[model samples]
Target: MNYTAEAPAVWDPAFADADDCLLSSDQCVIHGEHCFVKGLIEIPVIGSDEVFSWGVWVSLSRENFSRAADLWNRPGREDERPYFGWLTTDLPVYSPTTLNLKTNVHTRPVGERPYVELEPTDHPLAVEQRTGITPARVREIAAAVLHPGSGGHR
Candidate 1:
């Protein structure tokens, strides 16, 4: 069985509150932010880097960010109401583990927006350099060898 010493929490729609929102199979209302549609947009996929960099960032649903944006747009909402959180990326890409990275877009929580770093963790390319893969010319040769059809090889 797939096992890890540190397993993550199970998906809980109830965890979504006014300050946080969790997208799941159903449109669940937790905290205070309401879901206008039920299971309409797949979690994270609607807002991921792959989609944002090439496609969905501009032409995607205006209604996607509508709720939080609408609340934020109001002046009184910022001061009076509880600050709702924001999805990590405007375009969240789905991963095997949890849903898309989410962060609190509030100022009340003190410093830093509640978002996850989108950088690669423990990059193989970075680690390979320490493994005696020195010389730019060697790297070029390896690259050409690995991907012959890339037109880098002779």
Candidate 2:
């Protein structure tokens, strides 16, 4: 199960139509300054062999972004060390805001998006990543993401 946000919350929606921005489902760049890449934060689902994932964007330093872009299609890129990044998406279902959270963008082998690992913190999202969540929780997450103001409940 997964939910994907196409662009970071801070992004100006109109900027996508402008030539100054680089916009795609998997990556984004703004005026050559801010750079972001979409990666999966996979959380194991408890009581089952399943995973709940968020396909979210994380901001990377210009150098790291460039390095990632350079090796994006190359094999053996998975060997590179994880890049430190800041979460750029605001997942509103979480109470204390999911934006600006710390993360590590782990490069994968060819043909795969980077695996983003959230820093273990007290935040609910971070805790879920470390501990895992139940299927009921997964359904709630889906409801929250799908029903707007439902707050992940029936």
Instruction: Please tell me which predicted candidate would have the highest TM-score against the true structure.
Output: 2
Q: Tell me each candidate's TM-score.
A: 0.19, 0.95
Model 1 Cα shift for residue 85 (angstroms): 3.4
For each of the candidates, the C-alpha root-mean-square deviation to the true structure, in angstroms, is: 15.4, 1.7
Count of clashing residue pairs in every prediction: 11, 0
Best candidate, lDDT: 2
Candidate 1 has a TM-score of: 0.19
The number of clashing residue pairs in model 2 is: 0
Identify the runs in model 2 with alpha carbons over 4 angstroms from their true place. none
lDDT of 2 at 56: 93
Tell me the lDDT of candidate 1.
Answer: 0.27
Residues 9-127, candidate 1, lDDT per residue (tens digit)? 32254464535554432223333443321211111212222111101111112344354345433444434332233221221111232223222222122121111222233332212
